[model samples]
Target: MPENRTEISELGEFGLIERLNQDVILRNPSTLKGIGDDAAVIEAGDHVKVVTTDLLIEGVHFDLSYAPLTHVGFKAVAVNVSDIAAMNAIPTQITVSIALSNRFSVEAVEDLYAGINAACEHYGVDLVGGDTTASRGGLVISVTAIGEAQKDQVSYRSGAKVNDILCVTGDLGSALIGLQILEREKQVYLANPDMKPDLEKYDVVTGRQLKPDARMDIIHELREMDIVPTSMMDVSDGLASEIFHICKASNVGALIYEDKLPIDKQTFDTAVELNLDPITCVLNGGEDYELLFTIDQKDFAKLEKHPDIHFIGHMTKAEEGKFLVTKSGTAVQLKAQGWKHF
Candidate 1:
């Protein structure tokens, strides 16, 4: 008889994660959090420790045909750092593990580490320890980041209150736009080996796609200004998806303004060039690595003038429903097309 089977695609990425994590029993009292937040939280003596991990597989998470190994290494660390930033914590240490096939020589691995070290230095985090192993497929990288924050200062996805202002840092949609450009160039190269790819003009979007920087600086600035986000999550799965997570976790709804949505000139233009809607890209595009958060109304004055941060919307009661108010004064239901991976 044939064995019973269920397609992973049917469950999707988040669904698969949820199913796998359903049985992750925490045996230690120190495990304040596990498999749910941007990072796990552990009870420390004076402060809480936030831990996060990310895995990058060749072809699936990245394509080496265009993505340089250095950038891949850098991104591997930055994504984890972004999660720590989402928790309003400062990254302190990281352990990097890599699985490489024989196709990668020692020098190639060293080049990857060069970028990893650079990211560590950039984020002010120490490299503690990790494992190295052989793989039959392409390269795989996984990183675990540890961060610390005062218990009170730690922001959770569940902290948003009604009337809290929804805030997003920097512009959105750039990374997705950048990815389109890269993919287009790759196709061009594959079609004709002699044709040189024209990439110089699309640097802004391509750079955003290739190597994204976590908004750790923004996190630091918030601490310096004595502001704590009521609820926060990193914009790894596009603005709309992250908003839905924040809303669900906090038991609230959000009202975001279409006009207030931030988009880069390059992103908008590229989206138009590719015949993709810029606004749709902003709403559903993923991997910007910016922070999506809600702040108390009283703290708005402190960040009102900050040029990088955008005040996009505010929180509402769950029954009010999640919406995006258009420039023409029409309200539309917000939809989440987060990373599907299934």
Candidate 2:
């Protein structure tokens, strides 16, 4: 008889994570959270530390043909920090490890670190330690970020309650549209090396793709307002997919409004130019790095006058199921078709 070989593709990314996490047992009393959240929470004396890591590979997470090494390094750090922010923590330190091929020279590595250093300064994080190794494959970067917050200030995906207001920061879908523009330009250049890429017109979208800023600004403002969100997560995945995560973890449902979804004018225009539905892009596009969170109804007034935060929807009973109330007054089931590594 043949040994049963389970294909990873059949399980998908989240499903695989779930399957592997099933048997893992947390034995330490200090391990406040192990898996199944944006970041792991470890108990500290008066405060808790939030830890998160991310892996970015060449040709997979980025294309060196278009993406500058500097931007890649910056993004690598920003993503991990974003995860920390999702837990309502202030990032303090990061350790960066990189695997390099011969293709990258010392100057190339310096350029990469230039971006990394810039991000470290930008986010007020220290580059405490890291590792380096040779790789036959292209560049690979791994970043582990440590953040601090009061034990009570930590937010988890499982904390959302029924009737809590759903809020999102910045805009959505711009990064995905920017990726499309970059890819289109890459193809154009490949077909004709003499032609220069005309990216000045698409600068906003392209910038969003090349260098995404984590919404740490919003996190700081939330702290100032003394509004600890009921639940939170960064929108590294698509808005809808992240909503699904919050709902599943919190054992609740969400009803987001179509008209309330935020999209930049440039993102909308470019998505249409690419023959993609803007709404779909906003819902399913990934890598925006914005914050998606829910707050108690009482806290809504505190953020209502805020410029960047948009109140899109509210949580509902688990039996209500997740849905999007479309502009046409149709309530449709929300789907998670975001970025899938598998």
Candidate 3:
């Protein structure tokens, strides 16, 4: 190893972000937030604007062998929208940029745009503009989403107080399980060209991986019920990992119950079939795209009756430490093995 060189794996994704952020200078008064959150908050008169972007690269972020171009395009936009939703904001517009090689045809580009347009329609966000460029490599897509929220309505990752109820939207682990299934099928197809991909029974799990829906409906519901989360983020990097983020940002601790973790029947059964611990999948698998949030104890009842929301735990004092109480009455320190770009 060279004296001044270090591997990116040593720093990891969050570590790299932390190191990069050390040199950042937030000079503009209008730049309410620069980093360390799901989206950047900017001053926009009565309502603040939240902006977030995500890039998807072929082979790295996706495998085009099994992943349809359409799903890839839609997912590219959905992930960015998920970030805005994490901030308790409403998505209004998006700009898409794509780079492709000669291997892709005009029709292939159209298919990608079809899914992008569908997501735009579903989310009610306008596709205002984008850029098209040539790439020597595989397909690349970058989407930037802009959303709106009242200055007071926005939820920051650092706002959770001790004793706030921890909640998550939708079930977990299905996406990772789905990815596993997809990869398995890809291997099978590669080994035998005559064999067709077996994807019929795993539609639910597969769809969770391919076309995840951002929790915008819940955001709208929260607005209607006049409930703003004290702290919130999307479950893109697994449940336990996100809990650690909330704890670190809010300067608090957390205690989540094993039984309280939400796992879909299909996701659970498939994990078992794949010889994976379902609970482990729920804890460490990434890309669920569900909302993880904290609510004031007093505001819990306002959202208690919602069918999709699951109350998993509550915040604790900083000195107590973050832990997960097992179903067998064992209290263990929580671990974070979330998605690491490095």
Best model per lDDT: 2
Q: Give the alpha-carbon lDDT of every model.
A: 0.94, 0.96, 0.94
Error of model 3, residue 144, in angstroms: 0.7
Candidate 1, residues 53-89: lDDT per residue as tens digits? 9999998788999998899999999999999999999
Q: How many backbone collisions does model 2 have?
A: 0
Instruction: TM-score each candidate.
Output: 0.98, 0.99, 0.98
| Clashes within 3 Å, all models in order | 0, 0, 0
Q: What is the lDDT of residue 95 in candidate 3?
A: 100
Query: Any runs in candidate 2 off by more than 4 Å, and if so which?
Result: none
Clashing residue pairs, candidate 3?
A: none
Per-residue CA lDDT of model 2 for 1-342, tens digit only, reads 669988899999988999999999999999999998999999999889999999998998999999998999999999999999999999999999999999899999999999999999999999999999999999999999999999999999999999999999999999999999999999999999999999998999999999999999999999999999999999988999999999999999999999999999999999999999999999999999999999999998899999999999999999999999999999999999979987
Better of 1 and 2 by lDDT: 2
* Model 1 lDDT, full chain set: 0.94
